[model samples]
Target: MSEFKQLYKPLLDGANWQQPDQLGIEGTEIGHWLLEQDSLSRRFQRHCEAFTVSLIEQVKISHAALTNDERALIGDEDCLLRKVVLQGDGQPWVFARTLIPISTLTGQERDLEQLGEMPLGFRVFTDRSGRRDALVVADVGTDTQPLWARRSRLWINEKPLLVAELFLAQAPIYGKEKQC
Candidate 1:
């Protein structure tokens, strides 16, 4: 178990996730990021002068530790939990967490386990057969400083992986204007 997982999983579990429309973010930029079907990494690349993916940790998570929604999608199987920070122009913009069921890492999909420092969108989006479902949005962090987030299940060739992205306070989107 990683210290990062220990610290953040609770916050993720505590989130009250709902659809973007349910939260009244429909016409906003934050809503755009949460609801858009495009590759978020590609969007950031277009908006920022420089972009990078920083891996924080990748570790196996026991089936017992998964949230109910996670278990429903991944079938209570042990999975790899990958955490990374997406940076734009040297500033931390998004914190991303992914849960990959061990069973899904077979055949060509095994490459997912070795994507060190590569944006996940680079791999997941390249496959034409991939699709997403259960997109939900939430506000995490403390009451005084809330962070926007979105969670969804990405299906590639019928295999499932859960992905969640939290927009950090320093993210370019939270600036005076939507910078990125």
Candidate 2:
């Protein structure tokens, strides 16, 4: 177990990223990172003027069973899955996977049909009517030691879309690890 997992897994994995003000959770290193309000693109740009979003994989995949909160908003349906790494000065900082349900695609939201290398935050943050839902934060992987991750639900034109963004363990804040 990582020093952090021993220190915060009970606090992080079980956390409802929405209520960040909860006791015993404040003043955490990872907590501050996840609490940033700036668009991810802008944040990366600040880190390096030559920041880039490298497309890792994007595909339309069969939807898997979702959690209760997710199913309540966007019904279970095949979704467009986009995975990308946000790089700062050629170094990867974040691994982001955005899942846009086919059922939620309607009207202008359909513009996501071809995202290419654009940051999903660009599409969601720019919408005047769009609103970000409470983030669901966790660090869930095979190791289960805990890493930083945040899930956001953006409502554009009343259409709900789910996006999950993970802060790579090597992302400099928690202490950089080998890039590979």
Candidate 3:
């Protein structure tokens, strides 16, 4: 197996990219470089920015659900959910939502220090037809992990009965002997 394939096999096999507590030296370096120059990074950022704006607009429209007093109390509810969208070139776009509580607003702000950062992981999915699809990095968080409890309904129309979810956790290390 090639180096790239070896590095990403676990993630591809798992079908869920999970962030690890700590990345290896080489992994960290690669992550940094990719975030700066990869085509995937560029596409991901574009889509994520657009998705976030759209989500915010949606939230604003739904603000009517809250009473006037409640709206005034919350002031800007945008702080509650931070949306990130990613779309790799020639790849399907991915939307990720990070939920932040009002209590830790300051911490959340600090976490955005590396708002557009990418982690040391990549994912590839194969459809029933045997075609491979690349999964883009949609978001990263520090104040709190994103809630993946609710399956996103966005995939319903595209793939009937399909439910998409986000999972934030540690990724398994690829042992040297098991490379690829």
Candidate 4:
């Protein structure tokens, strides 16, 4: 259990996820910010004239096993866990992480492993299986104020990949000035 905990430490899986339309968010502007339509990567591009995807970490951990939810979507496969920050006009905005199985990277998505600093959604939206669905949205933070986040599965040829996007605490949508 401790090993599982440590492996998923970088993720914010502490709270339960809610559906946007079903969730009764009255006074929370943050909730609305996270419920934006279309792919987040595309939204960032449209909103910000100069958007960037900055890779933070990409590693292979043999000791780490997938969570039950992840395993269901990704299957019993070795994955490349990659994390990145979405910056808008040089301002830190959203933090995104993806768990991509090695098998998925070798097929139609052969180019995915080489995305480097490019947005993950670029490859995600290319093929017919790029549509994102079965989303889980939540708000997480150790402090009193929590940031909004969403997760979903991206499928290609029936193979699944998990993608999570978190609206950072310092993100402009919360309180700061315009990002673009």
Worst 10 residues of 1 by lDDT: 1-10
RMSD of each candidate?
Answer: 2.4, 6.8, 17.6, 4.7
Q: Which stretches of candidate 1 lie over 4 Å from their true place?
A: 1-9, 142-144, 176-180
Quote each prediction's TM-score.
Answer: 0.89, 0.73, 0.24, 0.79
- In candidate 4, what are the lDDT values of residues 1-180, reduced to their tens digit? 233224333555654677766665634665555665346777667667888987878876441577787787677778988878888878767777789888877756777778889887777776666676777787666568767778888776676778888777666657743545
Itemize residue pairs with steric clashes in candidate 2.
none
Query: After superposition on all CA atoms, how large is the RMSD of candidate 3?
Result: 17.6
By TM-score, is 2 or 3 better? 2
Candidate 4 stretches with Cα past 4 Å from truth are: 1-11, 25-33, 142-144, 175-180
lDDT of candidate 1 vs native?
A: 0.83
lDDT score, residue 156, model 1? 80
lDDT of 3 by residue, 87-180 (tens): 3332323333433223323432333223342311121011221111222222233347422211211111122111122322321111111111
What does candidate 1's lDDT look like per residue over 1-180, in tens digits? 255456665666777889878999888877777786757888788777889998999999899989788898668899999998899888878878999999889988999999989998878889996778889988987789878888988888888999988887887666544444
Q: How accurate is candidate 4 locally (lDDT)?
A: 0.71
Best by TM-score: 1
RMSD, candidate 2, Å: 6.8
Candidate 1: clashing residue pairs, number:
0
Ranking by lDDT: 1, 4, 2, 3
